[model samples]
Target chain A: MNPRLVFKAALVCLLLVLLAEGVLTLAKRHAPFFRLFQNQIVSCEILDDLAACSLKSGRPLIVVMGDSVVYGSDLHAHGVPHWREQALAAGLQRQLPQATVLDLSLDGALPGDYLGLYAAARRLKPDWIIFEYNYRMFSQKFGSPSEAVSRPWLRGLMSQPLFPALPQTAGDKIKSVLRKVSQLYRYAEAFRDAFFFPSREEVINRLLAQVLPSRSLRDPGDREMLLKLKIKPHYYTPLLTPEHAGLQAVQLLENELRRDQQPHLAFFTPQNQEYITEIADPHTWPRNLAILDSILGSLADQKRFFYWNWGALYPADAFYDHCHLVPRYNETFAKMLAGIIADGGRRDHVQRLE
Target chain B: MFNGWNENIRAFLLGLAFFLLLILILIFGQDLSSSKFIYVDF
Candidate 1:
């Protein structure tokens, strides 16, 4: 509480912090390559992968946007984890061969987050964009884009339409600005998750699984999980109201695409029909889907826009958990996507399967 | 009157502790503190 002591301590802390920041900046510059794990890629640092990725001739750039569905979440069930070589972008790469596929997806990405992601991705000048429309985005549990962490991702482009909600506080805006200023602040997690002990969580869980009882262990066999695992309450339960944030975010994205003439394919992300039909709320799921269809069906300007419902393409076994696919299925999904693109993503090529 | 460094090692230790704490938060704890509202079960 002494004024002299407080002043001295404050000055010392500031000087030390500045010194550490300088050291981190130097370390980053000399490091061969800074790799960001898929989970570590929060918000628009999706650009981190693109910046590190080897650029080809830049003929056809396919930009993928979605959540864990594209991230290959439960691929580990078959002794195969979400390795980029085995994931969707890799599959798409093999399918197209010449094209560059950028898979910019996080585990919990929502519809609101994509505006900033797309705004950031524009710098890459993508030729075709494939966005996965997960029905979970409609859940009220999540905030709209502008109100979320994406405020920083959008950067100076605040004047753009669709971002009506302001940040939670002035402190948030300042923190975001600071994040932009310091790479050390922004990518510290990327450094940890990528360089050191990437599997710290995995190792701990494995140890517990060995000593713990089967019931306590998180692992349930696939068949058992299929029978028991219920979809989280957030799935397909967006309240149908005048200010439905999820649907509104999608509409705003559609408006952006329409205005920019950005060729895009927005599809209903593939769902495990058997799991949904067996476990999830049957009435709410379909009802909300019908509501979604009506909204998309009514959206203006269909030119340069393609919406396909591939929701039921996979059966029970294709899924690892709720909505995530087993690794091999990612390759199969890639072929289907390749066919669509190879056929020029034509309206006739996209069939709406109920 | 500006003899604050008379505390010497105490001042240095306080500064060092604060630096490590800041660095730790910047790396692992940044996501925890900032995105508490954003749910990520992964």
Candidate 2:
């Protein structure tokens, strides 16, 4: 073995890898490209991204948190897909141009996610936290733990023990250290998908669309089928009591936020009331949110913590389906939220950033 | 021909190709999204 030749080759490879990582790191700073792969973000990986997130010091930061209702697909909209740009955060950004809006929401996210998200958002030092309080979260009928909550990283977040009793394996320790050191290794999926055309998902989806009947996960075109087959069973389940994992996670998130003196605003996720009544048993389902509403209402301090039931506020047309809002309605939703966050209930701060 | 400078350059190119291919496969081969995840399991 020639040590000199090996060293030269190793140095060349290292430089090439570093060069690639440098480009990805720089591209991740640009918000549009940065958010392109936001779906793949796990709880554990958020802090590093937030730490490197650059914002103008004077600009007030508003972190919007929730699930698909807060960040829905643009599959419904024709012409071209704008994805997150047409979602709630961008709508809020438009409404409150003075402040920077960070959409920390994801598809199928639950209350169990917010603890990890809030933990990550604290790094951003946000002025206001606006989130969707989806009533469906109260239903433990989904999965025992749910795939959303059982993500490898999220499994650990949910298992927050009083002591560091859990043992880490050799591989876990190495991965943890590597994640801390290398953004490339940590978000390799995001970087690769962003750089590749017709991404790996798109490729699989195109191929799968051939053999499988359903092509997309949240295809807006599938609403009629979703309503007939899936919606009733999913939404009409009995509300799990206070002991529900999601409710417990919500309580913990609220408690931590209060301890940190962080102000937050949450509205009962608005749905198409017309369609809801069709599936809902009237006493349960949608009423589950109302039940939770009274419970949350007991602790409501509008000055610091704002929670309201806004489920029936919008018309059927306002929603893309039964839950998510259309882009124009999203702007309306943003305006209403901005009014509260800017006014601070007492009109303490400027109503708008400019 | 085996002892020529061209052979050394060819070997370096071959090694670099193998390294890049390995990296590319590792990065893009797998689907991170859950296979059995149903969207309506709200």
Candidate 3:
């Protein structure tokens, strides 16, 4: 066969195979395999491109940086009391009475995403930036365990034969291409699942069935401590030990604050009410805050870093899960942050050399 | 050069076909509004 003929034949075969796969996927939209992929779509649609999508509105910004727990997983299911960005805005306005709030938080984000956030902060220049993280998120590889959860959809899509065959580009063009075909199957399967799979409420019921009892874990004080030196519940020894992720993130944040000349504050988000009680107990809580104290001490003795221990202020029911504060707490946290920003913050405490 | 150009052209055409399909879905398919993910807004 001539070279052109050979090329044409291969091209035709490739098209035939994709067409066959596409047809098979559509025809079996009711099948278990097809249905599984559709559920994956529902999850992916919820999870996709979070960093870009959350910031689409041009409101004032309050970026939440951390892991799955800080992403407001529980808050999403329960309505935001004031509504998320709205709640932050309200809290700030209630405090500053003149500020707006924007929320730019992606669940499962690691330190790498913070670098992006630092740039966004430089550009958008929000009144405040709230960095929240939990114990489980810190890890040696890829910075957090949320990567493990996010990887399945990403890995599934990437492993598809079509992903590698495409011309590589600066963006996720290949997934976007496959997503077109996948969405067709997604709708077909979602329809069938709607009929035979389950209603959205039923699916939620089934999902909640798997949420381990909140009481299965110990109370705040009794919960296992990950860091011996730190008084906090769980501390992953600085990613900067063999290498440092948090320090690098701090440098970026500091540079941004300096460049923008915007005041910033750092506060520990007490995940549970019990954590608050534990931190308040003079016997141990103050010791746990030693890490934070060191951080504050290093920063020119300025009180710009406001450490508000709300653990004692809120009760247990305020948290929906092990780590997430219910919407009311989110409001209170925002209100407190807004107050600090309105005060022109504590950097005033820093002594200046003439 | 001709063969390489031919391969490039073939891949581009195929990729373009997929891209067009996505545009159609975006225009016609059900709402992938993603606002429902409001649970954990970015």
> Top model by DockQ, which number?
1
Q: Kindly report which residue stretches of model 1 are placed more than 4 angstroms away from their true locations once superposed.
A: A1-16, A19-32, A36-57, A143-163, A189-215, A221-230, A236-239, A297-303, A347-354, B1-14, B28-39
DockQ of candidate 2 against the true complex: 0.27
Question: Each prediction's DockQ?
Answer: 0.30, 0.27, 0.04
**How do all the candidates rank in terms of lDDT, highest first?**
1, 2, 3
Measured with C-alpha atoms, the lDDT of residue A286 in candidate 1 is 84
Question: After aligning candidate 3 to the native by TM-score, how far in Å is the CA of A133 from where it should be?
Answer: 4.4
Summing lDDT over every window of 10 consecutive residues in candidate 2 chain A, give the lowest-scoring window: A345-354
Residue A292 miss distance in model 2 (angstroms): 2.6
**What are the per-residue Cα lDDT tens digits for candidate 3 across A70-100?**
4454454455542444343344555554444
Residue A250 lDDT (model 1) = 80
- DockQ-based CAPRI category assigned to the predicted complex of candidate 3: incorrect
Q: How accurate is candidate 3 locally (lDDT)?
A: 0.43
Tell me the TM-score of candidate 1's A chain.
0.77
What is the number of residue pairs that collide in model 2?
A: 0
